[model samples]
Target: MKLHWSPRSPFVRKVAILLHETGLDAKVERVRSVAAIATPNAAIMVDNPLSQIPTLVLDDGTALYDSPVICEYLDTLHDGPRYFPAAGPARWAALQRQALADGMLAILLIWRQERMKAPGQQLPDWLTAFATKIAASLARLEADAPALANGHDIGHVTIGCLLSYLDYRFADLDWRAGHPALAAWHAAFEQRPSMVATRPDDAQT
Candidate 1:
């Protein structure tokens, strides 16, 4: 399998961490796809209409997209118990965690857009919306960080990526300060080899 990849993107990092955690790193090849957001990447758009990174092209030439879908596909490829439980409350909880993380990413991207444009081009309304969403999301996650009692699950992976992104893009926000349990959870997750390997360099991929 070939992974359409870029190291700077948090979404891409999520998939990379999962592949590494599941012991499938050797089986998958990482090809640095063109930068679609900063620069037009026709090849990626050809494969995926959305022109998103972390698109997985299976051995048979089928392509998968977006971080969540790619991660789910990776989970199925593994044998034994899945990182994502197949039934009941486990699946719902995992999905909820993933959604929260995904929402965090979306808000960060919006903030990035507002920051990147000309100083006078800032979108105030959009910034306010994104900021509110991010604040609420983090508060909830901090208050009740997902439990990882039975080894690492998809929820853990999602939260790990979310926290890592905050550190990478919005370190000044100091998300760890107001939330002690989340801080503790992130401290433990930071020790994992997968998290270490996928740590954001923020120095351009």
Candidate 2:
């Protein structure tokens, strides 16, 4: 398998962490693909029209895309603990958490793009809305930190990546200030071998 990957994308980082956790890192080759919202890469568009990272191409030419789909597919390949619960409330809870984390990532990406524009070109309403959503999401996570300790699932992987991304790109926001519980959870999650190995600053492959 070949993965269209970028060192700095939180979505890609989620998949990378799963690969490490499942002991499948050696099974997939990481291809450094640059996918930007403003500039589409022809290489990635060939497999994923959206030009998204974490696009996985299999040996038979099958392609899996977006981080959630790819992560679930890879989960089936390993015999270890499942990142996706098999059924019942556990599955729904994990999925819901993943959605929340992924949604925040989407917001952060757009917020980042908007902030990158000249200050005068940035829309105040959109900026304020984005900040509001992030704060609410962090509060939700803070309240649910206890549940996060039950198991390491796709939700945990995504939330970990999301928080790390804030640290990486939005340090000025000081996200850890009011969300002490969530911050404490991430402090330990960030030390996992998978997280440490895939740190954006140190990523090479």
How high a TM-score does candidate 1 get? 0.93
lDDT of 1 by residue, 22-69 (tens): 889899988888655667678887778777898899999899998889
The Cα local distance difference test for each model comes to: 0.84, 0.94
Off by over 4 Å in 2: 202-205
Deviation (Å) of 13 in candidate 1? 0.8
What digit string (tens of lDDT, one per residue) describes model 2 on residues 1-205?
Answer: 9999888889999999999999999999989999988899999999999988989999998899999999999999999999999999999999999999999999999999999999999999999999999999999999999889888899999999999999999999999998988899999999999999899965454
Question: Candidate 1: misplaced stretches above 4 Å?
Answer: 146-151
Q: Which candidate is the best by lDDT?
A: 2
Task: State which candidate has the highest TM-score.
Answer: 2
